[model samples]
Target: MPLRSIQSAIYTTTMNHSLLFTRFTVSLILCFIASAAVAAVAADKPNILIVFTDDQGYADLACYGNEANKTPRLDQLAAEGTRFTSFYSQTVCGPSRSALLTGRQPLRSKGWGMPASEITFAELIRNAGYQTACIGKWDVSNRKAILDRMPNAQGFDYYFGTLGANDGGRVRFHENNEPAGATDDMGSLTTLYTDKAIEYLNEKRDPEKPFVLYLAHTMMHTIIDASDRFRGKSAGGLYGDVVEEFDHETGRLLDVVDDLGLSENTLVIYTSDNGPWNQPKYTDRKKGHPEGSIFWGQSGPLRNGKGSCYEGGYRLPCIVRWPGKVPAGRVSDALFATIDFMPTFAHLAGFDVPRDRRIDGIDQTDLLLGKRDTGREHFYFNNAGVRQGDWKYLKPDAYFHGYAIEADRKKVDELYNLKSDLGEQTNLAAEHPEKVAELKALMRQIEGNDPPGTSPIQIK
Candidate 1:
């Protein structure tokens, strides 16, 4: 009860409290370190970024042998990744997007508007705990009732971009199903999408979770629009300007990934939905309509562009960059398609492919990693024909050359060895009638296997 006893009790209490606080602080630091380590380990699973451009041709970039449109960033991307010499996508926007998202031919899935019943790559990756985002042109379907068929309902955690192409005065834009704005000014669309993507990498995405960012650019399609910063920047006219702007925005996105230290772990792929819309059909070009020539994109040495079943229509330019995993500056003439991305990504991310439905995509993990050279052996191009090995058989009236050919003109089955005839100029169908029959039989087999509800295989 004396002063000395009271002081001794206070000292004891203070020392006890100090020891307890010190212990708590040390435990907190340890827990923080352990959490950081766990996140780092999870990051090893790698993130995915798909830079898909609409209507971009195989020869659109510098690395693809284009002399005019100088896409330094994309050229560098090709240099840092594996560039595919022969890649395929659907002949149109909606089908191509559907194929990439679902890993099944549009016919195999439910055609244009990706059916709600089909699974998507985003859904597959999401099941593995990854953050999935789709930013830019999502032209799967823009119809009101099928609006849910857009990226958000399909599986994207966040969706920002247009529902269709930016070819008209007004492009429908949305931010996760809700309307963002309908803008006639297409100049800023690329910047908006790219900035949003960078923001996702920098802020929106959970740092501990791997992410799938599909940035589908709207430029390089019809009525090409470029930002003011890229006007008159190249020798290829307005089309060049638009492509260069896309390249710049792509560089900005890559820079952000590097800044965030995600470059090493991110699998970045740059490709197109289909070949360029070089010859847009105009039954009558009245006053204000967009001139196809002003925004024409080249398909290089290939015979015809867009809308055609020829080499130019669906043969795409694909670049895959994964730092040490994918070989740098490697050019592969292997056969791969947009439909293969779902299974390939699922394979790389250690996820399971949807077992309930039939997926047409084959895993190309080994092919992309440079362990092998070939990917796909047979690819069916909508109405074109079946391309197995080097043989391609065209249907009697399958080739649709946009505005170049008369719609009612009659044609015959044509076959070509793609390995020797990349341009498809020399038709050997008459010479090798047996080969043509084989391709026709394969086409018939594929059609017979088509899931119910698919439109009858349209050969004409």
Candidate 2:
């Protein structure tokens, strides 16, 4: 044990310690860089805000060819984005919401019978690191506020609205899973829902994380009313009043997005659940309202209205705006539907669609971004019939929700060239048996052994 040997051992130990410290410092720097990179990628993900309205007609807004209703905000939205001419939802409310959420046809999603087992787009997008909130009418829980099928259970981080429609001229509210009381002031819904949504965007959501805000308004449906300020102010009557108020409220929400500087990176989709209740058979029932008879929405030139298997029953007005990303002032006639949102969100949000269940939605990211002109080549009308290209074939005895005329109840297949007859006025099933057979076969192939009529659900 010489002094020289002990000193050398001490020096070697110190050198080894210094080398380990240097390596640890370098590893810390690399880890910090990796974490920063991950955060940057997450921040770059775009926000998705879907504003869904109930029972809005295809030509409800000025941009959609309405001459009476003044929807300046929504018209500006259409001017700033692509207005889809051939967009669709479902023939009714519950089924349409079900299709949008699950991306499956109502027959498979079971519409009002949608089980807790069904996976929703919110579930998928939330899993992909997006903060999700639903701040309005959520009718998919069979309008009963079934806990497991409600928004909170369906993967929304925050839920603040009715679990059902305001069908009885009243709606009960829920915040997350807890009851938040009820309100019968149907007129206040549009602004109230918009306020909640703006609050979520400003206060509830994590600014660092991308988000999905689904604001489903409960206006323009049956038992419709408008705020005192808007009541009786439109040439389109009470329905127009409701629509104009909706437009203004929607503008407020969009303004919040702009103020927050999320516009360029946020994809905003405005659409409806179904066509308006324009049929006299349905409107006549609302004749005894205290504030005069509640008028129905106009279906433009389209035939029939909600609950029928005709163009007006399913077609809707859709405006998609993503500044600089989606072309402005573009009017697209390509076919699209609420069912397509699930898969498209999956693609844009970077999540895989559920592999176990059948999803009927096609990824229309290309169509949305102006990369493609055409959309889905074929769309099925539940079990009623199918539409391919310009030809739509309705099977004999096509199901209608108690609004079909005796003349339309004929026991023969009806076919129409939608290109020439957007109203579906011309029946060509006799002359073009080939097109009818082709679409019929397509329906049979897509629907399998499912029954022709929707599974009966009790409507309030």
Candidate 3:
């Protein structure tokens, strides 16, 4: 046992300790990566952002193949989430908003057709502890006398923008109902909605609570108003420039989410209330620059334009992005209605449907998660209409000049195999008489035909 032996023993011990420490550190790193992957996989809850536009078409988005229109931000959003091919909103403003709120068809609620009855997504989400905010257009039950049935009564903590359609329609705004100075000599309504929303995020957000922002855009469906910044920006027309401006403002919201570190946990939804305004004719006041386009905003082989009971009136463009969940850049052809929004939002927020409350929307949470197929195979449309898979059934007399005309004479009346005749040009009622009877029976059954206030349908 000499000094050299002692030195050799001491060196071997130190080297062994170093090797052991290295292995432990590597193992810890691997565990951290595995944990992160699991968290990504299991992160189901999301901050909901329902981005609703005024009168965009079912086929108006670049992602939806509206080659004429360019929506780079929305396109990028689509690339990161799910795009629904056959989403729906009402042909007009109020009813679509109503159906989305109550989870029931507009016809079923008091403000069913207009706005002033009861219930809303804001109320429900707020009950579930979400910070609910409605931007752009309220368009329904916002009047002071209608408090019991208004957005605040229904559950929104923050509200902004016009309470109705165009500022020309029923001008109003609220910073949580406290009106602020217009940001620009006229900022676009789109910019104001986004700016106020960002301010809410900056000042009121707790970082721990999930938020539900209902952005009801007043652009592209207005007095065709635009800020000085975007007065003339696109090739489509002034309306096209306005739409481009709308798209740019959307980019700002996206940036805010990224900057605020909310992107990963937020579910941003983009859609329109319905398709274009019946391509309004141009007069001086009607300058008609923003009346949407039959020339540019295509319904992609769908029958008819807005205001008609055809696909254009109700069918809409829908895109959803939840960073860590939902398949990215995928298109979904799932049949969803305005009525379904409430239930979907509730489920995403982890709230339960009240048993006493007659919730009409089926909880398609599995569909939203991309765990199920898109062909929902079931849904009821506005104006006593019904669509089950490829066969869309109108009540033979279900025309709605405004939105809910009880007796529509030139109604398509029969059913069309949507897969074979999506344009709905043919009448299959005679050949498939049995199918007609079946669908007609369902329409009456689901509607329950209070049969007192409106149209009557006692078949022969």
Q: How far is candidate 2 from the true structure (C-alpha RMSD, Å)?
A: 5.1
lDDT on C-alpha atoms for all candidate structures = 0.81, 0.86, 0.68
Which of the numbered candidates is closest to the native, going by highest TM-score? Answer: 2
- Angstrom error of the Cα, residue 127, model 3: value is 2.8
User: Better model by lDDT, 2 or 3?
Assistant: 2
Question: Pairs clashing in candidate 1?
Answer: none
Q: What is the lDDT of residue 295 in candidate 1?
A: 69
TM-score (all chains, Cα) for each model:
0.88, 0.90, 0.80
Model 3 bad stretches (over 4 Å): 1-44, 111-117, 142-145, 167-170, 178-187, 280-297, 402-412, 449-460
lDDT of 3 at 162: 58
What's the residue-level lDDT of 326 in candidate 1?
96
- TM-score winner between candidates 2 and 3: 2
Instruction: Judging by lDDT, tell me the better candidate of 1 and 2.
Output: 2
How much does each candidate deviate from the true structure in C-alpha RMSD?
4.6, 5.1, 9.1
